[model samples]
Target: MRYVKLPKENIYEFLGRLKEYGTLYAPVKISEKFYDFREVDDVKKVEFHYNRTIMPPKKFFFLPREKLFEFSISKAEYKETIENVEPFVLFGLHACDIFGLKILDTVYLDEFPDKYYKVRREKGIIIGISCMPDEYCFCNLRETDFADDGFDLFLHELPDGWLVRVGTPIGHRIVDKNIKLFEEVTTQDVCNFRDLEKKRAEAFKYHEDWGNLRYLLELEMEHPIWNEQSELCLACGNCNTTCPTCRCYEVQDIPSLDGDTGYRERRWDSCQLRSHGLVAGNHNFRPTKKDRFMNRYLCKNSYNEKLGMSFCVGCGRCTYFCPAGISFVENLRRIMGIEDKSCPSEISEEIPKRGFAYASDVRGEDI
Candidate 1:
């Protein structure tokens, strides 16, 4: 690792130099308490201290809404249209958000490769920042406090300025090109940097023990807490929208103004929507709100285990955006029966249904 110092005042010059690579994106203050990633021409617009953005940076690569194909109505035929995405750099990304991107990489590039997503992801560079956790954050529980890989370069805030660490060969090239911007690291600098990170970790306190989350979710299939919480759920989908790891979407076709030609589009979809699981002939598998709610937890905790990582980064964005004030941590505790010790005593000798009470409904409801 190399140590570099960019005078707080000269940070703008660094960004200006990076613009030659491609368009640059950094956090910008959009409103009183909302920040977002936007095109950056002026380095002053970069808000490095932002706790979190209203939406994750994933939208840059896999847009929330995008055109997937174009169709000709006359022939009733379609042709796939690949987007030629330009190379770019993502700056000021937090560790939790980086983990989110890794999840997307696995889903889109490994399982079933998405050409559009892969093209964009391969062309971009990731520059991550170590952000101090806010009151609502629990990234440590998900073991995303610090990313060892997945980033080209990582920056840690220092009292004098910023300490930059190169994580990949590509990262080293950038630093070497601007060798004048950095200085050799000494034993004292390393000690100071490690000490700073140690102190920062203390500020983040785990709300609940997440080490046993997999075990808890395995045994809580029949818990009644899901039913109670579903009553207050508005199904607004704010949680999914704000969540960095949620990847569900739907495809649609839009006709041109003349109705001769049209383009197929893919828009972000939510599992909370009643029609999400609907099939032909109006067959809905998960009709009840409680069933859908339970699926979110199971997918995040249980299903993700098979994928080699937990889907939840513990960013707490879901709890922060829930209109009904439903806390994910609280729900996890309920599912584990940690709040009620007597729940284990009620376990039956015979295992009940596999939590498929609504399987009879083939036609899903509309959102």
Candidate 2:
């Protein structure tokens, strides 16, 4: 990995150069405090210091509603609609959001890969940006506050410039193409970077040990918190919709008026919905609110051991969008019996910074 400097003055020029690769999409401030990823007409509109977007970049890959194929009623013929997938550049992604994308990759890019998702992943270029943890964020405890991989390029904010880390060949080529706009990282730059990293780590509101959360969750399957939360939950499905790692979707066949010709389409689904687990004979696997709610939480925490990571990146979207004021971290803390512990003013121990490590920090390397 190589670290370079992108002076603040050249941000527009750098963004302009990125347009050569694909259509640019970045965070744009829509309301007073809300931001969402939209097509970037002007690079100046990009929100460099956003907390979190309303929707995750997962929508780009696993579309909310997409037509799988068009079939003829007379003949058994189908045509895939993924041939027109175009390249796109998703910029200003936070560390947790990037990690969420990696989780999706493990599911869709592994065995039984979906061609639609595969095409989107192939055409998408991920450009991550460093962000400070908000009051709702708990990515620090989840170990996803800083992403070391799964992005083409990641930028760390600096006083007068941006510390750009190249993670892939495409990312390196981007820097090389606009080499004149960048400068070599200096000793002072490294110092400033470390200071920023420390500050960001200290900004997190939750710093408890999340290493054993999955185990605790497994043991507390019948805890009362699930019943309590289920009562408050409106079955709104906002949590699943906004979650970056939630990948539940339902497929349907839309028939024409003649019922002969039609197309198959899939749309996003939520576990909180009553019809999610409905099967033949009017039977629903997750019939009650508590069952559905607990399933969603368990799926995020204990499932997917093969991927070696929890489904939740601790992005806080689920909690943020919840209308009933249900907090995922708080619920987890309740399960772990650590609801009384407060965030310490000082970090208990040194926080290991992610991304490109300094030369001196690299073991077995001549400094």
TM-score of each: 0.87, 0.91
lDDT of 1 by residue, 3-65 (tens): 565545556677777777778998999999889889997888899898888889889878899
- C-alpha lDDT of all candidate models, in order: 0.78, 0.86
Candidate 1: regions farther than 4 A off? 1-9, 257-260, 303-307, 337-367
Q: Write the per-residue lDDT of candidate 2 for residues 126-199, one digit (tens) a residue.
A: 99999988899999877888899999999999999899999999999988988999999999999999999999
Judged by whole-model lDDT over C-alpha atoms, candidate 1 comes out at 0.78
Candidate 2 residue pairs in backbone clash: none
Name the best candidate (by TM-score).
2
In candidate 1, position 303 carries an lDDT of 40
